[model samples]
Target: MELFGTEGYVNVSVKKICDEAGLTQRYFYESFPDRVNLLAAVYQHCVDIARSATIAAATEVIDRAGVADGPVPAAVIPILAEEALGGFINSLVEDPRRARVILIEVVGVAPEIEKLRLGAIHDWADLIAGFASNGRPTTPKQKLAAIGLVGAITQLLVDWQMALTDPINEQAGPDLFQVDSVHEVVTEMFVATYDKIFG
Candidate 1:
């Protein structure tokens, strides 16, 4: 994961990976058929981390609000959205390697990997739609909206990650990297979508 995140999947060799892990090629092959399989596992790990972080953050908010059993109150939705989005974004921002693997390295891989990536996106959409619907069965429109929102958020984060590497964006200052700004924008977008779909 570290090698893929830092050196990129295309650039890193299996020998290098084995050297990094102090493992033999035999051992590596025992676990994964090839580098792509390892990349898939790493990608899935990153996705799980982000999803777990988001759920944990939202659960904390809900627990604190004392609304564990019932639907989350509409009044707390914005705060919930902010914390949840922050958790998701911060998981990546705090680990640039993970961010690069997820947002950059994972793109245009093999067809199977692409399918896995799409499945991850739909899983995220299901999660967001579930939250927006407050555990209710999401309508097709709600599911579609959630998928669109997830795509937008993914692209926004990718742009943000790119800006971090682009020297021209340096003048944009520290605020550009602040997770709060990203969270605010996404939270507003999410809340508005929630209102449109479930208000």
Candidate 2:
């Protein structure tokens, strides 16, 4: 992760990775067939951490709000959304190398990697959709909207990490990388859109 995070996939070498791990190339080869394989493993690990944390955050909200016996409380939706978003955002912020590897460096790396990325996106979208609908069946429009929202958020974070969000380039007036402002805006947008889709 550190190697790929620092030098990126194209620039990273097996020697560097092994050196960083204080292991032999033989050991790396024993575990991973190639660099892409190593990248896949790292990506999967990071995704698992992120997914688990986000789910835990949502579960905490559900437990705290005491929504086990009935439909999720309407007021709890924003809290859940915020908590889930915070979990995901903090995980990336805590280890931006993982974020760059998953969000930026993995782009166009391999068909399998791209497929994995899309699959992860859809998995997250499914979770958001289910939560938005309060476990009710989602309409086609709602499902599509959920997917779109996921895509938007992913791109937003990607741009933020890549320094693509400058004041002149964005119509939002300020750089979107301002973490707190971005978090607040994203939460508001998500809550509003989720309600519109499922309310």
TM-score (all chains, Cα) for each model: 0.93, 0.90
| Candidate 2 Cα lDDT to native | 0.82
Cα lDDT, all candidates: 0.87, 0.82
Alpha carbon deviation, residue 178, candidate 1 (Å): 5.1
Q: Quick one: best TM-score, which candidate?
A: 1
In model 2, pairs of residues that clash are: none
Error of 2 at 6 (Å): 2.1
Q: Candidate 2's residue-wise lDDT over 9-92, tens digit each?
A: 899899989888899999999999999988989888888988888888888888899886667877888998899888888888
Top of the candidates by lDDT: 1
Q: How close is candidate 2 to the true structure, as a TM-score?
A: 0.90
- Cα misplacement distance, residue 133 of candidate 2 (Å): 1.6
- For residues 20-49, could you state the per-residue lDDT of candidate 1 as single tens digits? 999999999999999889999999999999
Clash count (model 1, backbone only)? 0
